[model samples]
Target: MFSRLANVFKGIFSLFIKDMERKNPEALLELEQENLRKQIANFNQGLAAHAGLAERLMSQVRKQETEERELHARTTAHLRAGNKSAAAQNALRLQSLARELEENRRQLAQAEETYQNLTKAREVAVNAARSKIEALKGAINDMRMKTAMAEMNEMAAGMVSTIGGSGDTLSRLHEMVEEERTKAAGRARMARDSMDMSEVNIKEAEMDALADQALAEFAAKEGIALPGAEASVAPEANRSMGSNPQSESQ
Candidate 1:
């Protein structure tokens, strides 16, 4: 039972971690990038150790070659001096040096090859990881943009529905505006119909007569012949002559 409970708790924790990873993919990607860097550093350290070994082996081979050359020269000199024992001993030592040199060369060659392989492996792994990280970054940006667009589209759709809904605020506002406009127009028409025009017409006629009298007086003062004044005087003279016989008969 305790084991089962532990398993359940582990499952819950795992689920929570997975949820966090899903929600924060960039964080997870950054973590993976950091791990990749650490792994590469560790691999490089190992490669450096292997490269040091190869260098040591190469140094050993060179040292043995130098010793072999010296031994060969010594053996030749001893033989020429009729010292067979020393020459033989030197030859034996040279043979052993040759074998050791050959072995060191083989190990050096293998180490160099192993180092190259590790280098290539590191390059391939790092390249693959960088490509995946870049791809994930692009995908995250695209997801964020698409998510924002989806939210905007949803909001726009909601606004459209709300604005177009029957008896909504916008509709009521339009109705109220139209009703007020119609009432205002009706009130304007009623006011126009109710206004008395007789006084206005009388005032307008008086203003016209005053203007004409002012014009006649100005024309007379300027000694300007006025055709309108002459016309008016002729009409008054005709009316006086026609009314003289009526006044005598009365």
Candidate 2:
């Protein structure tokens, strides 16, 4: 039971960590990059050690070659001197040096091959890691941009919904402003109607009377016959004739 509980807790922790890694991929990428660097460093150290071994093998081969040459020269010198024992001893040593030289050459070749393989492997690994890192960077940037766009879309949708809703602030403000404008217009009309207009009416009537008198005088001066003027003059002439019987008799 305890082991089961521990497994459950471990699973929960792992899920939590995975969630964090997903949410913060850049951090994960950095961690992977650091790991790559460490791997490379370790790889380089191993390469250096291998190179040292190759160098040692090269040195040994050179030493064996030099010994073989010296021993052969000695063997020839001893044979010229007719010292058979000395010559045979030098020849035997030369044979051993030759064999060691061949073995050293073989080992050197193997070391070189190993070193080249390791270098190539390290290069391949580094390249693969760098490529993956770059890809992750691009993915993270795309995800960020997509997230921002999604958020903006959501905000815009919410705003649109809010604006069309009855409880929208701007809509309420518009309604309030329209109502105020209507009220103001009604109030203005009421104020205009309530104001005193007796003086204005009297002044207008007087102006009309003056305008009519002026029109009559202008018509008389210009000798322009008006429709009512002839009737009025004929009546006046009749009255004058009645008042003056002498002129009427003449």
Candidate 3:
């Protein structure tokens, strides 16, 4: 049971750390970059030590070459002077110097090669790490943009559903409005149909005609030419008005 509890806690901690990493990947990236820098620094320190060894070996090789040349000159001079024992001693020393010179040259070559390889390896590793880090930075930005777009899509989807519900209410309102408008139009049509205007129109026409007749007679009696009256109608109206008194007597 205790082990199970510990495992559960560990799982929770792992999940929490994963969540944190996701939320702040840049921080993790910075930490990794710093670690890379430290590693490079350490590697460079070791490389510096190797370089010092190479330099020392180069110096030894130069010194051995110089000693070999001096010993050869001394051995030749002793032989020319007829000092056989001294010449033999110089020859032996020259032989020893030759061997040492050869070995030092070989060691110098190896040290120089190792130093070059270490330097090149460090450069390649650093470049690769920087490239990967830059790529990771771009990936993180893209992830953030995609995550934002996903959230926006979810919000829009939620809004669409909410607005869809409101759309039903709006549709109902429109239907109610249309029904009321149709009812109002029907009521107006019915009221119009129920109205009787034929007799009223005839009465109004008769009154208008009478008023025109009175005006025509007054114009005829006064001998005034009325505007918009037919010339023949005015003379006929005067003759009729002049006969009205006689007709009333009869």
Candidate 4:
């Protein structure tokens, strides 16, 4: 039953913590410290209350001891004055009250001891709570710093990627422009250096071959078989081989 009550309270407290976290984490942190302080205060208050009770009990015990002593002296005086029965009754009442006070004092001492231990525990708990808060705050700050650095690094990477892409695109554009210029230079040479003599010689050789083929075609059409013979006779009658010295002597 006691455990069940403890669990119920724990669940309620956990819900409260979650709500605090959702509302304002920083505020929740402060609230947690406040809670620690409250706990310490409560502990100190409880210790003080028990100690106070012990003090009051001790005061009553002292008063009771004095009254008992006075009662014993009266009972002895009464017995000595020949009132034995009344003295016995008075002594019994005093002894009974003394026993009760002493028992009360014993309980008060036990409670005071428990309070002293609780005060010590409260001190330790406060120190531990404060240390935990400090560590958590440091961790939170470090995490924030690391998060900021990570974001900065990511932004830098993005900028670098953009710059690198622009560099590559510009370099490629320049290369393309140079390639077009080279192609244009080649076209200009094709236009400026039109057919020179060597090019003309090559075309004339092609034309000569074409004329021979045409003559062969015409000979075939007219059924002539002496085209090669006519061509050979014409070459032999065309010009002298060289300026001859024998021809000058003749």
Candidate 5:
């Protein structure tokens, strides 16, 4: 029972972690990138150690080669000096050195090949990981942009639905404005129709007569005959002449 409960708790924890990873993919990607860096550092350290081994092997091979040459010269010199025992011993030592040099050379070759292969493997793995990280970054950005656009579209759709619905605030406002405008126009028409024009016309005519009298007096004082005065005087003069003839005849 305890084991089962522990398993259940572990499962819950795993689920929570997975959910967090899903929600914050960039964080997870950064974590992976950091892990990749650490792995690369460790791998490089190991590669350095391997390179050091190869260098040691190379040094050993070179040293053995030099020793082999020196022994050969010593053996030849001993034979020329008629010391058979010294020559034989030097020849035997040279043979052993040759064998050891050959083995070191082979080991060096193998180590060099192994180092190259390891370097290539590291490059391939790191490149693959970096490419995946970049791809994920692009995908995450695209997702965020798409999500924002979707939210905006949904908000716009909601606004359109609300504004276009009947009996909404804008519709009521429009109706109220039209009703008030019609009422105002009706009131104006009624006011215009209720006005009495007879009194106003009489007053207007009196003002016009007063203005004409003032103009005529001004023209007489200035000794400038008005056109209206000339017309009236000519008609009066003709009437008087006709009356004089009548009176003479009578």
Candidate 6:
């Protein structure tokens, strides 16, 4: 069972590696990244607008404050002219200017407060994208790995797809995985045979030759390597018995 799972993992992993190398799914990764960037851009624009408004409001307050100071100065000059009626009128105008300036100052203060709050919000929004970007990258990598493994299976003797009349994808995936596993197991057996042959301290010349040459020479003199021992025929039948995950899940 573990062998079967190992095979499946290998098959799946190959697809992922291929995708990563090829950057085959660039569209998917780009689309997600673009979405996050757009949101951040929108937030920045709002913050910029808010800051601009605050600046404009402060400028208005400065102008009104200056006007209020000038109106008071003029009213004092009228009082010193010994014109009581004119002085009274000037004083009333000065009071109105003062009130307008005070109101403008209040508005400027509120605008500044709002701008500060927006600055903080903008920081928070931009900071939030860091985690989102990382997550998107990881998701893309994972998808790439799967796509690569699938392609590898196609290149190998394994079935790349099960889109045929009666078969399905999951079954085909398992078949491919098992096929790969058997090939691996065959290589393992050959390595073991070579190790055993090396231990006997056979003639250095004999060992120098390829294993195939030594095996052939021994076969002619005596039955050496088992029949078809060189054949890397994997146990396709054993793996054929396993069910495909796609079907199992269904």
Best-fitting candidate, scored by lDDT:
5
Give the TM-score (vs. native) of candidate 1: 0.80
TM-score against native, each model: 0.80, 0.75, 0.70, 0.53, 0.79, 0.46
Pairs that collide in candidate 2 are: none
Q: What is the per-residue lDDT of model 6 for residues 98-147, given as tens digits with 9 covering 90 to 100? A: 78878878888898888888788767866777777778678878877887
Error of 3 at 185 (Å): 6.9
lDDT of 4 by residue, 1-250 (tens): 9999999999999999888786555677787889887877887787887888888887888888888888989999999999989899988988898888789779878877887787788778888888999998887777778989999999999978876785677768888999999999999999878847788788999999999889888887997876576788676765453435557878
Could you tell me how far off, in angstroms, the CA of residue 249 lies in candidate 2 after the best superposition? 25
> What is the lDDT, from 0 to 100, of the residue 106 in candidate 2?
92
Off by over 4 Å in 6: 1-26, 142-250
Higher-scoring candidate on lDDT, 1 or 5: 5
Model 1: number of clashes? 0
Off by over 4 Å in 4: 1-24, 42-45, 167-250
RMSD of candidate 1 to true structure, Å: 5.3
Residue pairs with colliding backbones in model 1 are none
Error of 5 at 13 (Å): 3.9
lDDT tens string, model 2, 35-97? 888989988998999999999999888888888889989999999999999999999988888
TM-score top scorer: 1
Model 3 clash pairs? none
Summed over model 6, clashes come to 13
- Per-residue C-alpha lDDT of model 5 across residues 183-246, encoded as one tens digit per residue: 9999999998998889899999999999999999999999999988999999999999989988
How far out, in Å, is residue 173 in model 4?
11
lDDT of 6: 0.77
Candidate 3 positional error at 83, Å: 2.0
139 Cα displacement, candidate 1 (Å): 1.5
Put the candidates in TM-score order, highest first. 1, 5, 2, 3, 4, 6
